[model samples]
Target: MIDQLLDRPITDFIPQREPMVMIDKIITCEGNTITTSFLVKSDNQFLSGNRFSESGMLENIAQTAAAKVGYECLKNNEPVPLGFIGSINKVGVVDYALVEQVITTEVIIQREVLNVTIIKGTCMLGDKDLATCEMKIILDLG
Candidate 1:
């Protein structure tokens, strides 16, 4: 069963813990593309009014990319490294995601050189765009 292959929780893929771990699950992962989802809940740490703050949006994007990298490591039987968003550019928030809504995030790896990877990410709530950004992630391979 597919569940047998990906039985580990999303928390296993990223470094963040409760209150900071925003991504709920990894929906798909193929090559340079990864898709993850998060349910915007009333008890979420970033919830403001009915939605998440702009910082929360950016973290979601970064973590999506982190999930991709983590998945790759798991597949290769390597240790999952710590990574941080070194830079973010061209960020735009088109709409606010509300509580009780599920936000799907997708990230495509643009390029990687040495220990840095550049990615383009987008967050969507159904057909509406919530946010998009290009980020550079610095990986700690040690």
Candidate 2:
């Protein structure tokens, strides 16, 4: 089931549309961990000069988490729920990705209660860490 979902267009699993969409593909979704990949384009909204900004990396992490929820909802034949970033904590930015670079982000679910989920996300460029943060997402199922 998981293999069939891999490499598909990122829009299928994430509610974000073009321009605002930060992730390009879902690399893996298993258990409490989800990974995604995004190519930093020259015209990306979050780009400043040739570098992808910290805010963009943060959005990528959140979108990766959303993909996990969207993937599970798809598997259960449910509609994709809208989600918002409630808060962010412990943010650390070591570097920024340049244009044409591919960013790999990994999100680990920390907890889920009702419509709220807590996760830790780390963004990487190859083996180099770019940024990491713990985010709380609130889902709207209504």
For each candidate, give its TM-score against the true structure: 0.95, 0.96
Cα lDDT for residue 125, candidate 1 = 89
After superposition, candidate 2 runs with Cα above 4 Å error = none
Q: How high is the lDDT of residue 133 in model 2?
A: 100
lDDT comparing candidate 2 with the true structure: 0.93
lDDT of each: 0.90, 0.93
Residue 25, model 2: lDDT of 86
Give the candidate number with the greatest TM-score: 2
List model 2 lDDT by residue over 1-142, tens digit each: 5388676677878889988999988888999999999999999989888999989999999999999999888878899899999999999999999999999999999999999999999999999999999999999999
Question: Per-prediction RMSD in angstroms?
Answer: 1.3, 1.2
RMSD of 1: 1.3
Q: In model 1, which runs have C-alpha deviations exceeding 4 angstroms?
A: 1-3
